[model samples]
Target: MAKYLILIYGDERRWDAETEPERAAKGAAHEAFRRAAGEGLLGGHELEPASTATTLRSATGTAPTPTDGPFLETKEALGGYYVVEAPDLDAVLALAARLPELASGHGGVEVRPIVEHG
Candidate 1:
């Protein structure tokens, strides 16, 4: 089995714009995923904070620095992610499609494989 990271990207700002019902729905979605994930339906996962993140880089500009917020300028950022062990990317994509948080609305989900380091 291959380990993949299901990155959930979206407009964090829009979360504030969502109505009460919308927020509730999102919460419910999260709960559902948690339950499923615990049951081996989902391998392992985590939900990160909003797009406003800290990015640091070297002072000499050797590497991009992280400060109070994200390095990239975009409406949708890497808000959260899920780590799952699946057969392949397609299997992960199928899981991605089922995520309401990444469903049609704010942004899209990105499927990527993880590299192990000794």
Candidate 2:
């Protein structure tokens, strides 16, 4: 099986402003996804807001520099991710389509196969 990473992106401001019920709904949706993924869900996590992020950059001939925040400033930020083992890209895409972020229309998911080193 090939391993794929499912990256979840969303607008932090909108997510923070969500009402309790709306937040709960999103949580439920995630729960549903978790159940559906089952054994296919190798690992996953919800990240803290982008504001809490720290980034590191390295120069061609210098030590790495540390910065406080995401690498890029964008309306949408990576909010979470999941690592799953699937037969192929098609299989992972099918599972990604069920992500709640797609339903919200505020963000989307990206699936990329993990490169294996033999």
Candidate 3:
């Protein structure tokens, strides 16, 4: 099986404003996804808000400079991710399409193959 990384992007502002019940609903959805994925689910995590993020950048010959926030300014910020092992891209895509973020209509998923180094 091949491995894929599923990146979940969403509106941080909206997510922050969600009520406790709303958050619980979304969490339950994620649990359902985990159950569906079963053996195919490798690993996953939900991140803290982008405000807590630190970005580090370095030039070819300079020391790395740390910034206070995300690497880019955008309406959507990465909220979570899942790494899964699947038979192929199609199989992974099918799994990704079931993500709660997509159903919420405030987010989207990106799937990328993990490069294997020998």
Candidate number achieving the greatest TM-score relative to the actual structure: 2
Deviation (Å) of 18 in candidate 1: 1.5
RMSD score of candidate 2 (Å):
0.9
TM-score of each: 0.75, 0.95, 0.94
TM-score of 3: 0.94
Q: 11-44, model 3: which lDDT tens digit per residue?
A: 9988889899989988998898888889989999
Question: Under the 3 Å rule for N, CA and C atoms, how many clashes does model 2 have?
Answer: 0
What is each predicted model's overall lDDT from 0 to 1? 0.71, 0.92, 0.92
| Candidate 2 weakest lDDT stretch, 10 residues | 29-38
Q: Which lDDT tens digits does candidate 1 get at residues 6-74? A: 787777677657899987887788677666555334444544554446777786748765688667687
Residue 46 deviation, candidate 1, in Å?
6.4
Tell me the lDDT of model 1 at 7.
80
Instruction: State the TM-score for model 2.
Output: 0.95
**What is the RMSD of candidate 1?**
3.2
User: After superposition, which runs of candidate 2 have C-alpha atoms over 4 Å from their true positions?
Assistant: none
Which runs in model 3 stand beyond 4 Å of their true positions? none
